[model samples]
Target: MTRTRGWLAAVVDIVLIVAFALIGRSSHAEAASPIGLWTTAYPFLAGWAVGWLVVRGWARPMRLWPTGVVVWVATVAIGMLLRVLTGQGDVAGDPLPLSFVIVATISLAVFLLGWRAVVRLVAARSGRRGRGRV
Candidate 1:
């Protein structure tokens, strides 16, 4: 159940990130390319995998937020580097503002952290109350 929940959280986070990117793109006139598409999608998938592995598999709440932050930051940096290496396009396209990056990072971090917190809190409370009865 925990594993399933963690994966669900990750999928939700991916959706949220994509939504943010679309919202940011609404203000722009040009259509984003396929190269840009992968740039946005891959990072969230990577972050999602890491979040699930660390939080659900290991049952470690302490690692959730910090690891998420690290993964998101690194993902962004690596993405920029990849775009630069390929020279396919500018790292910061018109749609992806600095503000958008910050918001996306926060969104991913919060979703990952909040899910773990809720799961642990519920389990802890249940355990405590259950112990009293048994």
Candidate 2:
């Protein structure tokens, strides 16, 4: 991928993470203000950054293997760990509920990996078309 595409992929990932936070907040009837969204998003965003570094994702930003899967796992794991450490919870005593964890795991996987899958499919089709043309 070109540098521009790599950066764009990173931005897309960040936007999706923020979207996840927004949806969660809205569903819970929590505040939808910027500050509220930031509070919910920062942990996951931090995790994403870590994942990018760990995988050097810029080298292959669109790959669904180590890049997408590792980033997805890191985002959820680190995000939840941070939330627990910071005492953020759905209920008074449960900092990380099993139901919420499951939902988050599935939601983020779809959000993060789903886009890459679509991009790969489109690129594959375009490549085939280009080859047939020349």
Candidate 3:
């Protein structure tokens, strides 16, 4: 069950990251091509992978403390770094403006951490109900 949950968490993270890129692209009226989406998403996905390794997320993938927080930080930090390094910023010749960084940080935080919070809350409520029943 844990192994399955770990994989599920990883998949959910990936999906959310891609969705972040997709939404950003759409909002900016950029071409919604697969290549563009992949270009935008891969850096954050790589950061997420790094976070999983750092946290050994498979052990407790659903934990909001170390796992989710580390993943969220890493995804934003590393993702922004990569975007700047690769010249993929919102504007040409100005890789990684302050506004873009701020927006990306907040947006990715919401995307990466929001669902885990919801899941944790739901699970807690369900567990409480089960305990009361027994």
Candidate 4:
């Protein structure tokens, strides 16, 4: 991938976060307005930014193990921490509920890391095929 496509990866991460928020809101039957979606998205967005820093994502936006995993983990960790602090997290009977943590971790992992992994695989196969042709 070229340097220009790095921005596309960033955009994808942000869009995925927004989509996650939209789907979550829909699942809960919450109001799906721009403001509401933004509110739901901001905490995780902040975390996503931190994940970028933590993983130095611009350097390797599509690296799956450290780059993708670090981003995914940081997005959930920092996002959940911020959410709990701000009282926007999905808390039920308990303050730091296990169900909420487990669900968020798994969902965020899949959404945040899955796309990059797919891209990495495709890029690898494309490279191999191109080499074989010449």
Candidate 5:
């Protein structure tokens, strides 16, 4: 495996992550311009970075337990925290809704961790069969 792949794993993460925001926006018929999407994405992106720092994610970016799980949790937890600051889903005086919190937590976990788990599974199978056996 190339060091570039390992080193740029976070970039892959960033793309997949931003996809969540863009998809949600499209679903709601919101403008999907780059600036608009970036605004929506920044909070989660910051949370993602925080997650990387918390896990020292580079050391084991592909591992499923602490790294992937921690990153997923941190992304949703901190992303929701930042969302309260952004005033997007607030209703009345409440900055964050219970349903939003629950949805964000579950969805982010699935999206952020799911692919890593799949890749690990595929890699394990491929390795067991010797490379290029696909």
Candidate 6:
């Protein structure tokens, strides 16, 4: 997929993540700060990054599953670390909730799976061309 497409997916994922976070916060009466949003968003961004990396041929798409998972885990962990450092949120034993994990997993899977199909479709629709006098 093109960078534009990757960004589009990332933005969409971010929006979805934000929506989910808002709902979760409202339901749980948790303080939803900017740091919370960022922490929530990192995994979505990571998924898109992995998708872009795969499209660019830097990594195998199948391998991207683990990469995306690792990225999501790392982003969430690091975000929580930053939150603790900044004193934005307490270092509760459970940094994130089950919903966050579920949402991130779904987001990563959708973006990674959808990206390849979209790229292939775009390429096929654009039609292949050959050089002359090869």
- TM-score versus the correct structure, for each prediction: 0.51, 0.96, 0.94, 0.90, 0.87, 0.42
Cα RMSD to the true fold for all candidates: 5.2, 1.0, 1.2, 1.7, 2.7, 7.2
lDDT (0 to 1) per candidate: 0.54, 0.94, 0.89, 0.83, 0.83, 0.51
Instruction: Rank all candidate structures by their TM-score, best first, as comma-separated numbers.
Output: 2, 3, 4, 5, 1, 6
Best by lDDT: 2
Q: Better model by TM-score, 3 or 4? A: 3
Candidate 1 ranges with C-alpha deviation above 4 Å: 1-39, 47-96
**Best-to-worst lDDT order:** 2, 3, 4, 5, 1, 6
lDDT per residue for candidate 2 within 45-88, as digits (tens), equals 99999999999888899999999999999999999999988888
Pairwise TM-score winner, candidates 2 and 6: 2
Ten residues in sequence with the least summed lDDT for candidate 3: 87-96
Per-residue CA lDDT of model 4 for 89-118, tens digit only, reads 546645567876797788888887889888
Model 4: residues >4 Å from true position, as ranges?
90-93
How much lDDT does candidate 4 score?
Answer: 0.83
6, model 3: CA deviation in Å? 0.1
- Model 3, C-alpha of 85: deviation from truth (Å): 1.1
Q: What C-alpha lDDT does candidate 5 achieve relative to the native structure?
A: 0.83
For residues 42-129, write the lDDT of model 6, one tens digit per residue. Answer: 5445544554454542343323355434444444555445544545433366555565556545654455445545656676666654
User: Lowest summed-lDDT stretch of 10 residues in model 5?
Assistant: 1-10
Relative to the true structure, candidate 1 has a C-alpha RMSD (angstroms) of: 5.2
Clashes of each: 0, 0, 0, 0, 0, 0
Clash pairs for candidate 1 = none
